[model samples]
Target chain A: MEAFHRIWKKWRHLLIYGFILGLLIISLRLLRWKYVIADQSLEIYIGIVALFFMGLGVWVAMQWFSPQSKTAEETESIPGQEPFSIDEKALERLQLTEREQEVLGLIVKGYSNLEIAQALHLSVSTIKTHVSNLYSKLEVKRRGQAIGKARKLRIVE
Target chain B: MEAFHRIWKKWRHLLIYGFILGLLIISLRLLRWKYVIADQSLEIYIGIVALFFMGLGVWVAMQWFSPQSKTAEETESIPGQEPFSIDEKALERLQLTEREQEVLGLIVKGYSNLEIAQALHLSVSTIKTHVSNLYSKLEVKRRGQAIGKARKLRIVE
Candidate 1:
């Protein structure tokens, strides 16, 4: 089970790198055997070994470079309020209550409504009222639009 | 301006390919120099070229084998539903009227309520009510939740 989990974790990287390496090996062997072969059987044997190594090399490289496996701490993120200034302006224009702004931030990050309610500790209805008020203030129609405008205005960085 | 554009269009492929080929040549020279003195330079140079050609061959192979970008027609879609289905559901649950669904779809796609109102021919307050309804139905308490739910369900795909 542990071995299976390990393989699943690294599968995407392994697949990409393995395929690239396999291509490299096959081309190298074909070229070598075509030009350098004196005996047919000998050339075929060398070609097979070269192909295997190439495939292995690619798999290793992919494992080395897979981006999805990076931990959160290693990921890049903007620090603090500097990114929120534009959003503040959008919020002001939208006349969103303070609570709505907080919720809006999570929305941009792709959280579900249930998740946001849990985070804010507010009744879903109250949250809805604030969102509605915000929609009127911003003169926008859709949630996607609200998020986009907030990002554009630096309201929810 | 036209002459410059024409020239750019005509030679773009040549310029790009040439630059890549030039880089390969330089890499080969560097690798060859690391191996030996002038006595073995010719043999080393040949080996380096072979490596460079092998690299290019592998790159071409990868391009050939990789999946092509998806087209709109190729996308799997659910029938008899708005493109943003989850947003529609959230809107319905919130008790937003027909106009609200239109506005919410636009918002999730990154439009402002005002723009949605203008497009939908509704008053700003009406748009606000719809947005509020969307927030409540999604139980998010914010415009962000509505949008996030929409995306998760492939409503925007």
Candidate 2:
């Protein structure tokens, strides 16, 4: 299924266009069957065909590319092989700025403020501001609390 | 597009069925034009219709649910939720002293030397010595690095 899905995802555009062209040929055959309609009616017939195909398109999209499909893939994933990923939800909920997140990550690893500033090539005072903001956003009073909360919440990895 | 998608996702089944039924009615009308075919051929025609619609479905799914269509919410989903466990092997390899192990765990939980000293009923100077020893054993120069290394090595939960 995974291999089939990969090929499907890669060649989907070509496949779709080819199918549409095939349908067009079929429609032309229908036109030549001595069932000649007026020009205006021909346009309407084409519209109906397009709409039907469009409905099919929407159904196909939902089946394989939706969030539900992603969830299914995740469940089928092998255990203990997936790489570490940060808790995006917690990060968003805390509304940490990119710089603050960087600072927080460093802090979690045990870097002092001066070391964090040096590593980031920022001033010590600037790192200090970011650290304070991190504390406020994380709603923690001390480094230990922040570190514990960050790990417990899986905010950093 | 997001709003339309929300509505479409909610009512897609109804929309798809209604569309298929509408096409069926149109096909019936064509059949009434005295274009009767053998039963086997009729089955083939239905198969063709089904295949065409399947193509259309695939096309539609790609357009609306593909990676390019991602919203902020989609990107913020929490991934695998694995629990923390101490790596006994790594702990053994590091050969941290009992006091150092306690200090390392506290440090991971965000404890400062003064706090760790207070908690362990040791002098601040003694806590600092234990911290230095932990840093050397962990091969880290800073608290941040130690914390990061400790977690990565799973030496502390």
Candidate 3:
């Protein structure tokens, strides 16, 4: 019973979501069987799917742009919490070039791409190329993610 | 200067992502102009867009399912936190029926429709209808989201 309780705690959310999705798909099929033709049913499916994704994307964007859990105090305390030092091996494994490394360092200091380009005597396009390449290699889509991964891997302090 | 610095800190990450997306779209258009036929170019555009969305979905799913910030201390302290009570005003604002509200409560506890149906002594189809109607009113796709909104609004503790 104790183990069942623990398992239920872990599995309930995902299971409920899966069950709801199954119900949705089953009902869509029923609608098609009763009323809609194949092509119109397909269109309805696509439209509903698109609308669902659009709402999901909006929810995600809200989470991203306005993080709920992070307090102002946490943000203010971040720089003081660490004396970050770069990890050269970690940098090498990420395949960052010397120029790209310089760009990333500037990013850690909160320099915008345009500002980094000016400082490095490179074009904005050049800076963007380096940034995107490094982001891909770091397996992160956002700047915060790249910085967080770098800090975790000891590539930056 | 201080205000500008603060604004830059807030907007920089989103700006960089937007800039990168713009570059991707421009490059796709250029590729179409220089190499591919119109029909094939359109297909490529759709393919790339789909790929981008799929990657974004993966990233969003990671953010949703694997929240990184909850500390051990927070979890341990949760029981000591203030007692959460249901907010009737919040429930009324969502315009949920009594049956729909019952389904939402079950959902918060991670109940599958089958389980909820068994407990409520209703058919699974009836439970599904109630769940779908509530989801539409809540404007969420997943059970996690419905629960999140409910907790946020104090509709469910």
Candidate 4:
């Protein structure tokens, strides 16, 4: 063990450097391959990649803001202000089952998954699955966004 | 000229190979430099970049589908069915001026920069600037995406 420790101490830095060098070489190879497959010219590859990302980012931005505007139109979002219109269309689009809807309501009411399970006389795992399904339907990750989008879509109220 | 051509033909492939090798070496060195500058260790960097792209692709897919779901609710997509809701909000957020809007319309209709300039009775450089500005606002690079996104956002319609 002492000898092993000694070897490790002596070669630790070299090991790290070697690993880093290997990674750089591999990454450079990938870059070079991409550069070649993209017409074997640096300028062309760069121009392509740059434009590709620009188009992609713009599309993403448009996707993000279009929905926001559709939902927020004529409904100025003051702090704690409720959305005036309940988007029944959006709710129908989400396709949440009745059980998932129950779990979502309790979730927005600040109940834990276990608490929701007990309240609904379901297993904790079942509640978790329901919550997850609801989140998937709403395209949200957290309780807050789930609740917010649910309200916005009129899935909750 | 004959002698020069004779020697050039003899050494042409060698010269090309040498140039390509030099570019690869330079590219590799630059890659090494970037990894160092980013304060990234190799494994962590590779892992992160891989996962980031995977996550980004999944999110993009979700976004692409979510809007489809919202728009296609109860009305399945038929062939050549026009998007019912024109996303005017996306255009409003882009902050395009009147002239730029006109230039964009021409661009969508397959007018070249020169054509747009002549049609608008403006200089080609002015048209170029307007096109560039429209691209900047739309966050796109290619004319196809610019036009497609414009139509999607209902900026043209």
Tell me the whole-model lDDT of each prediction, alpha carbons only. 0.52, 0.66, 0.59, 0.58
What TM-score does each model's chain B reach against the true chain B?
0.38, 0.47, 0.47, 0.45
**How well does candidate 1 reproduce the true complex, by DockQ?**
0.13
Candidate 1 at B104: error in angstroms?
22
Model 2 misplaced stretches (Cα beyond 4 Å): A1-85, A110-115, A118-121, B1-84
Q: Please report the candidate that would top TM-score against the real structure.
A: 2
For model 4, what is the alpha-carbon lDDT of residue A92? Answer: 65
**Range of the 10 consecutive residues with the lowest summed lDDT in candidate 2 chain A:** A67-76
Lowest lDDT 10-residue stretch of candidate 2 chain B? B67-76
The parts of candidate 4 lying over 4 Å away from their true place are A1-87, B1-157
In model 3, what is chain B's TM-score? 0.47
lDDT of each residue in A1-157, candidate 4, tens digit only: 9889768744664566456546744764577545545555544443344334334444443454223224332133222324356555555666778898788777655577777889989899998888876765665545644554554455555
Q: Name the candidate that leads on lDDT.
A: 2
Misplaced by over 4 Å in model 3 are: A1-85, B1-157
Native-to-model Cα distance after best TM-score fit, residue A79 in candidate 2, in Å? 12
Model 1 chain A, poorest ten-residue lDDT window? A65-74
The interface root-mean-square deviation of each model, in the order shown, is 11.7, 13.7, 17.0, 17.1
Root mean square deviation (Cα) for candidate 3:
23.6
Pull out the clashing pairs in model 3.
Answer: A84-A157, A85-A157
- Candidate 4, residues B64-119, lDDT tens digits: the string is 33332233121322234344565677768988999999988766544567646655
